[model samples]
Target: MIRLDRDGPVWTLTLDRPDKANALTREMLVQIRDAAAEAEQAGLAALILTGTGKVFSSGADIDAARAGLATDGVWEEVSSRIARLPFLTVAALNGTLAGGAFGMALACDLRLAVPGASFFYPVMRLGFLPQPSDPARLAALIGPSRARMLLMAGQKIDAETALAWGLVDRIVPREALVEEARALAEAPVAAPEHIRRTIKRMIRG
Candidate 1:
């Protein structure tokens, strides 16, 4: 499930399935995509993606995956929507980030993580390849070598290492994650929305 909250110009989307480590399900993904679309339509200044409890997300739901639900399309759609939002987007990784959930964080314009949080890519260990766009996006953030270390070697990187690799912009204390994310989200609010969106597009291109 997802929780959407608005405070002034910032819209926050929190993954609420803490009992399962916030493991993503098809229905949850749909809700997240819809909430993001709604936030964009409302012309919010920024969007924050985070999770409840100690894990950002455990990745796609195994039950859903076993049921043959197609996740690639949903992942692509949701990530693309967040990536192309006219306003700033931040991923506050309050805890562990693994599997497909990494793609969600990578899609965000900025990333913040709790000092104890960690990032892992388990595609090799899981006997599956990452989504096509994932490799390039990961490479873009932390460079090809580190991306290779993650994807090919199944390396798990701690917050400090991730920051050093340029994967996360900052590492905040667990208690300060939300406040820090809010501050980062507030940074571009004074800029013209069109200018920010255009520049984002140009940079991506």
Candidate 2:
């Protein structure tokens, strides 16, 4: 399930199925993709992605994956929409991030995680190529060799190691994750849209 919350100009999109470790079904992925589009259409200041439980996402729902969701083009579309958004984007990782779910976090401008979170993408071991945009984004964040560690070697990295490798920008306590994300967005949210867009373009260009 997916829940979108608005606080003034900042919107937080939460993955709400804790019982399943927030495993994503195709419907959930579509909701996430639609939310990203909605944020851009509304000219929102910031968008924060987070989840309700101790695991951000266990990746695609097993049943859905077996039904071909694993290689679905919707994954690329979702991450690409987020990556192209001009507003500040943050992935407030409540717990471990795994599998195909890596794409969304990688597309975000920043990623923050709880101290206990771990990161991994088992695409290779799972016998599926990752979503098209994922490898490039992953290499851009944490470097090719380290990207290889996760994607190729199938290693699970702890939060501290993730931070050290640049996979996550900061490690925040679980209780404060969303609050910290809002704080980071304060400036961008308050700035004029043009100014925010300009800075983002400058940095990303």
Candidate 3:
């Protein structure tokens, strides 16, 4: 279940299946991918990805993972779409982020998390490879050794550790998570689209 909401120039895509820790299914992944595309097409100035409950996402649903969802291309497609957007992208991690779900957040330009949130990707334990772009993107953010600690050793680091390791940009109180993201977006939202896009490309270079 994915909910995409538009508030002027900002678009927020929320994972709505709190009951299952917002575990992703193929259908949900498709929805997220489509929503990201729609937001970019509509010239969104900023996009935020968050969740409805204590967990941002527990990654792919267990049943779905076993059914080949873990290795699905849709995950890469979704993350790639987000990565290519000209606007600012933020992952407002509400809680733990695990498994294939790591791809989407890793693609974001910035990440903000709640103190209670944890980060890990258990591909090594689960006997599956991560999405193609995830490992490099992850290593770029947090460094190769730390990325290995999470991917190879299966270490689950808390919010503070994640911030220190560069996995997350800030640790915001849960109540203010999305608000903080919106605050970060204010400047970009007010700028011209071409100006924002130019700056983003300059940063990428």
lDDT, candidate 1, 64-102, per-residue tens? 866754345887778877877888889999899998888
Q: Which sections of candidate 3 miss by over 4 Å?
A: none
TM-score of 3: 0.99
Error of 2 at 78 (Å): 0.5
Task: Provide TM-scores for the models.
Answer: 0.94, 0.99, 0.99
lDDT score for candidate 1 against the true structure: 0.86
lDDT of 1 at 116: 87
Evaluated at residue 74, the lDDT of candidate 2 is 91
Model 2 misplaced regions, further than 4 Å: none
Question: Comparing 1 and 3 by lDDT, which wins?
Answer: 3
In candidate 1, list every pair of residues with a backbone clash.
none
Tell me how far candidate 2 lies from the true structure as C-alpha RMSD in angstroms: 0.6
Estimate, for each residue in 69-152, the C-alpha lDDT of model 3 and write its tens digit.
988899999999999999999999999999999999999999999999998899999899889999899999889999999999
Q: Across residues 28-85, which tens digit of lDDT does each residue of candidate 2 receive?
A: 9999999899899988889999999899999999999999999899999999999999
